[model samples]
Target chain A: MAMQERALRTRKSLIHAAAAVFAEEGYVPSSLGTISKRAGVSNGALHFHFENKRALAQAVEDEAADAVRGLVRRADRTGASALQALVDTTCGLVDSLLDDIVVRAGFQLSAERALGPEARLLRTWHEWVEQALLGAEAEGQLAPGVSPDDTAAAIVAVTVGLEVLAGVDPQWLAERRIAGFWELLLPGIATEQVLASALPEAHEGRRSEAEEA
Target chain B: MAMQERALRTRKSLIHAAAAVFAEEGYVPSSLGTISKRAGVSNGALHFHFENKRALAQAVEDEAADAVRGLVRRADRTGASALQALVDTTCGLVDSLLDDIVVRAGFQLSAERALGPEARLLRTWHEWVEQALLGAEAEGQLAPGVSPDDTAAAIVAVTVGLEVLAGVDPQWLAERRIAGFWELLLPGIATEQVLASALPEAHEGRRSEAEEA
Candidate 1:
């Protein structure tokens, strides 16, 4: 058991190191030597853990996929409205894309190649989101004409898009900017009444909480 | 004047060739030798026009920026209502992003680094769109309570995001998918009346056009 734990920890350390290097220098330029050096592991140890750089990259992507799925699952468990859950979960993702290097690398790397595990993870997230949108529509949380499939895809696109832009322009990742993003997005998916009531309530709550703290 | 014209054509050829190479091989991996070879020019001739690879990249980015600006300017000159112009202009950008390799390269390169000229170009585009949004709002063409700056930024973010995703997933870039994107986006910016009339017309037009042609 102890040996397994040690292996897991070593594997995680390598992934973290690899994600950072990949995000900084990109896939091709980021070398295995640099990743190993950053992980504070010998080259032989790095090789023992992963077969190649592509494997290490896949591991990083897999870890990211799991983290994202875990977040959605936690949101699901909360029994919140589907729209609310999606907004909260998406906001969490945006925060990570702005602040978390590993998550950013996972997204960037996944796009550059056809990594199967990573692709499956992303597709699963999309499916989960599609299910959530269907629920939101059935609940009448969505607007009259909004298609569940399109809205789900748009929400995913907008969330991913905002993150991509944020990754490039840090200033645009501010809390206010994220709030603006939600404002633009939620209206499309939400009924007019929900937009008039729930969105303002959520925004105001965050503002007041920030002030009180 | 004749010599200047010859130089202009050579410079244009170099920019086109360089953009293709950069898109395929990326920045560091794409060498000056490859660019010159593609352009059918000698290394000395390539250097005569561009001081280095960075300079060549800047030239390519400049060409792309100009293309984007030109597209927007053409949209603005359409003599449509401010809101109509905004929507049409955005749609034009979406088309260019889908079809134009130079624009794609510019966007990719800009996100990867904080190049000065590239930053300026993007900022200029952003400001232009913001100004247009402000005008639309003042003219009562925009939906009530929509902040021009936020909406403008969201538009930029969404468009850039869609383009990036399309790069990764061509399957998602299908006409039907893009139409879905417009459906989600147009409602937020359009007035209720405009949404009722304009969106359906535009959507059907694009759909039939995509289908028949």
Candidate 2:
């Protein structure tokens, strides 16, 4: 049991180190030597857990995928309008990306052709956004003229775009800019009555509480 | 003049070759050997035109900047509503990216951290959007409730987002999807009377006429 615990801890540390390197330098230029060195683990220990850079990247992507899945699950328990849940979830995601190298590297790796499209993580995120909008439209939470499909496309585009921009200028993912996106888009997607509840700022407390938790 | 023309042609070919490789392999991994081979030029010729990869990349950026500057100049000549010109320019840009590798490489290179913040092509484009929207607001062409600043932010976000998505999926930049974005957004910005003109398809003929010109 003690042996297993030590191995698991080593694996987690290696992943953290790999995510940081991949996020900054990308896949082709990243090396096992640097990753192992960064993790403060021996090269032999690194090989014991992962054989190659591809496998290491895959491990990082898998963790980020789990993080995204967790966001969707959390949204399921929100007990609010689907639209509100989506707003909260997207805002939550941007905030998470601000601090989480694993999640950010997962996205960066997915964009890389070297990974060979094995992850499909971005598409998975889009599908989740689509489902959220569909649920809102079914619940009659959407404004009369809004098309759920169109709204989903734009939302996915904006969020992904913000992620890309954040790669260079983190200011793109600021609380005000993200909240302002919802402010500009909410009036077109949600009825006036629900607009206040659906505002991104309305969910600010949720983020803070999560941070505290 | 004949020898000078040959040098200019060789220079243009090298830039094109470099852009294609950069777009495919990114900064660190791309090589002058591949670029020269792709351009069907000799190593000596490549070296004559560019001292190194960084120099070659700077040339690519210079061409892209010219393209962007041309877009701004064309906008000045549009002789139409500022909002409409903004829409047309963005859609035009998407088309340009599809056909022009230098422009495509320009954006990809700008995203690269090695390039630092020197390119700022995206910032220039965003400023242009802000100006267009500001002009529309000044002319009372903006819809009653729409704030120009917020609207410009959303538009910039969406366009940048679409560009990112297009990197992985070219289908994201299709005419129908681009048109759909305008269709969904026009109602919120342009008054009912001007709605028809703001739709992306409304400018399809305009694009083709220019293509023919």
The numbered model that scores best in TM-score is 2
lDDT of each: 0.73, 0.77
Give me the displacement of residue A39 in model 2, in angstroms. 0.8
lDDT of 1 at B104: 73
TM-score: model 2 vs. ground truth: 0.88
Instruction: List candidate 1 stretches off by more than 4 Å.
Output: A1-3, A114-122, A192-213, B1-6, B114-118, B171-179, B193-213
Please, what are the lDDT tens digits per residue for candidate 1 over residues B159-193? Answer: 66676677557645555555676666655555767
Q: Which pairs of residues collide in model 2?
A: none
Q: Which portions of model 2 show Cα errors greater than 4 Å?
A: A196-213, B143-149, B187-213
lDDT of 2 by residue, B120-139 (tens): 77777778889998898887
Instruction: Estimate the TM-score for candidate 1.
Output: 0.86
Worst 10 residues of 2 chain B by lDDT: B202-211
Angstrom error of the Cα, residue A179, model 1: value is 3.1
Maximum-lDDT candidate: 2
- Per-prediction TM-score, chain B alone: 0.84, 0.86
Across residues A1-213, which tens digit of lDDT does each residue of candidate 1 receive? 999999888888999999999987888778999999999999998999999998998888888788788778888898888888887777777777777777778887766653642365456667888988888888889876677887776666666666656655776666666677666666555776777564433344333433464
